[model samples]
Target: MKKYRITVNGKTYEVEVEEITAPAPAPKKETPSVSTIEAPKAKAEPAPTPAATPKKATPAGKLTINAPMPGTILSIKAKPGSAVKKGQVIMILEAMKMENEILAPQDGKILSIEVTEGSSVNTGDILAVME
Candidate 1:
């Protein structure tokens, strides 16, 4: 047994550990002849069909804001058809336990919000569109 002191989260504690030894290997049994064994036939499975995904129609020459990293949408600050200025915060995203502000790319009216609060998003997922 070994004694040691450990500190975690600003707390200290003393503990002891016992050393364990590996067990001896067991004796091997004789193998059966291959000629006496029978293999089962395998059945082929059909391929799965892909699910249909709804597409969002983006207007021409509009700016689309995408998520910077994988995260959950914490809250939305701007609404559709609302006017926003360049560098304005439009939404908040929670990623890695941190709250990140989603900002507007340029001055424009928000055409649509692609994601809602509490929605999980991946990197490059569309968040909103403006024009």
Candidate 2:
């Protein structure tokens, strides 16, 4: 037999263990019955369909740009009506002590500028619109 002390979360406990020399008892076995009843079958159900998302309708000729992460708008390089190419950097964002370039998603003119220099923004916050 052995004894030990244990502490957990500011709580203390004492434990003891003893060696066994006797053999373990044999497990019991059951006989199968000759006459068994079967369970009733359940009806199959149809799978549920996912609900359609309601789209945010941007003005017909315009599009909305959202922030990719939480950050401060460091600078704006595009103004309203400024022509931009797909993947062109329109703004600089500072997030997590790193600078990130917010780019135009498609070749289009800047329809509107929603954020200004030094403005803090969260993920998915609209930054600008291009069309």
Question: Each model's TM-score?
Answer: 0.58, 0.55
- For 28-107, candidate 2 gives per-residue lDDT tens digits of 69776798789899788887886653445578878899999999999999999999999999999999999999999999
lDDT of 1 by residue, 21-67 (tens): 98978877987666666788778888888664455666789888989
**Cα deviation in Å at residue 105, candidate 1?**
0.7
lDDT of 1 at 111: 91
Stretches of model 2 off by over 4 angstroms after superposition: 1-57
Backbone clashes in model 2, listed as residue pairs? none
Q: What CA root-mean-square deviation does each model show from the true structure?
A: 9.9, 16.0
How far off is residue 90 in model 1, in Å? 0.4
